[model samples]
Target: MQDLIAHAPVLFPLLLALGASAGFLAGLLGIGGGIVLVPGLYFLFKTLGYAEASLMHLAVGTSLAIIIPTGISSARAHYRKGAVRMDIVKMVGPGILLGVAAGTVIADHLSGAALTIVFAGALLLFAAMMQIPPKVRDEGHAMTPVKGSAGGFVIGGLSSLMGIGGATLNVPFMTLNGVPIHQAVGSSSALGPVIALPGTIGFILIGLGVPGLPPFSLGYINLLAVCVIAPLSVVAAPYGAALAHSVSVKTLRRVFSAFIIIVAVKMIWEASHG
Candidate 1:
């Protein structure tokens, strides 16, 4: 607590910046901020002097905690724009829940290098995905239950493994398949819980028997950071969504992509060096 207090001056601003960046990207691109948050937390925790072995877990867990609130706030913001597809969300929820559990278990076993490699791959893939323009299908609007479930599985697994809320993966899939941006964002927002709930639980279960875990850590999740950062993020998320209506998303996407690239680099650096 004393160490955290002394670092508050630096950590608070860092958290705010992270929250703001997350909101902006969520509003602009329909992503859940995990792409940025995970890598950022990795570096931040390292800076805070956490041990190497426990550092990535803390980063992943803490990232999940913050997503709990950020997801809700961002979802509401996009929902108000009538972009959410509730039916689609409902159809996919079951598969997503199960997949997240599976993914978390897989992640719990991987080393930090493996995790960093996965994150880097995701970032690169996302960058490529953005560049490839979506070609909306001219077919029927309704998606099949089987298809939705399959999509949910992918979203949940990737999100849990990467410690994301599946937004980054969700939005492009929807847009490419003919779903509108607003609906994609709203629906993806709801998916966060499906990912976070099981993922967080998985981390806890895995971390329980491990020795030398960080102080005040629950499995991998850090309650202190989550409690402090999530509230503001929740509030900020809606504001970002509302503001998105007026902003230029094209510009936002380009800048956001570059920002993600930087984070990827940092994570890779740490995984190799520390």
Candidate 2:
């Protein structure tokens, strides 16, 4: 806690930069910024002298908290562009809630190292999938309840563990099912907050009474980090949404794949070395 305050002069700027990038990516990718925020916050918190045992947990929780506002902002921006698919969101909502419930409990029991490993692996798998074009490229059938809800349940569980909104999985699923990439990204943006809202609260409740937490923490959600990051993310998300609408679908996929690969490799290396 003392270390955090003393270094605020330097740390604040870094956090602001993180928030800016995160917000932009949230809009661009509909990932709720969790994929970026988890690793970034973990690095920042580690440097601030937080215990290793709790570093990833804290980061994940805080990332989820920041996603709530950013997701809303990005979703609204995408909605205005007529890219968001409310139909899909409605189909998947219930499964997301159920998945979050189970995933939170699982996360609470896993060690930080385990969580990092899971996060890294998920990033790698998703990135690889994005680079590979679907073989058929045919329009998929309408999303049935069985498939939509079931798939959403799985995405929700995985996302909860990774401190993400369901976008990493949602975008891929929607695109494979014949939805255009732009609409997939936009729809994912709307779905992100649904995962984040309950997921944040779940993390908070699970983290309570745990020792060695940083100051101003609500469970695993760090209020201090959220206060700085969420607002900036909210403000920047609209711009990202605009950019998403401007670029070619191929370009967007390329950017997302490359970025995730880089981040995943870095995180994996650090986790292995540590």
Candidate 3:
């Protein structure tokens, strides 16, 4: 606690900046801001000389904790615009819950290096998919939904493991299935809490009694980081949603693709070297 207090000046500003950036991206892209938050938190903790064994877990946990409010704020903004598809949320909710539970278990057992690699790999795949333009289908027509709960389960599980809000995968999946881009983004924003809430609880439970956590931590979730980041992110989310409504879909895809690629590459390199 004393050490954290001593570093408050530096950490608080960084957390604020992170929250702002993450919230904007979440609203703008229908993402939960985990793609940005996980890596940022990892770097910050690493620099602070946190133990190698727990750093990535802490980062992932803290990111999910922050996403709860951030997701709500972004989802509400999109909902107000009539962009969210509650039907899809309802369809996938059960599968997402199961998958998140499975993912949290997987994450808890994995080493920090393994988890980092998984995050990087998933980001790389998402970035690649984003770079490809979605095929346009007949107006009001969408691809047949994949049968069963498998798709939702996979999405939810992958999201939990990566400590993301599932937007990176969900947006693309919905868009590819013939959902309108805006609707896809909006629905994905709504999915954030579905992924974060259970995932956060899982992490906290799994990490309880574990060693090497930073100060002010509850299980793997860092209270200090959550407190610092969540409010700023919530405040900034609406602006991003407004931007999403204003921007061209093509432009948003291109921008998000580029951003994810860079982050993915950086994480991959760091994992390899570390």
Please list the residue runs of candidate 3 whose C-alpha ends up more than 4 Å from where it truly belongs after superposition.
Answer: 28-30, 135-148, 240-260
Question: Which pairs, if any, clash in model 1?
Answer: 83-182, 83-183, 84-183
Supply the global lDDT for candidate 1. Answer: 0.73
lDDT per residue for candidate 3 within 4-95, as digits (tens), equals 98878888889899889988876686556888899889988887877887888888989888888878877898899999988777766778
Order of candidate numbers by lDDT, starting with the best = 2, 3, 1
Q: Candidate 2, residue 105: CA error in Å?
A: 1.1
Query: What's the true lDDT of residue 35 in model 1?
Result: 69
Clashing residue pairs for model 3: none
1-274, model 2: which lDDT tens digit per residue?
6867798897899889999998887667545578788889988888877777788888888988888887787789889999988888888778888998888989999888778788889988877776776432355565667777888889889888888878878877877666777888888888889899999999999999888888889999999889999898888877887898877866777787888788888777877777
For model 2 the local lDDT of residue 123 reads 83
Estimated TM-score for each candidate: 0.86, 0.87, 0.87
How displaced is residue 253 in candidate 1, in Å?
Answer: 2.1
Cα distance off (Å), candidate 2, residue 63: 0.9
Kindly list the per-residue Cα lDDT of model 1 for residues 5-89, writing each as its tens digit: 7888987788777767666655556566676677777777778777677667767777877787777666676678787788878
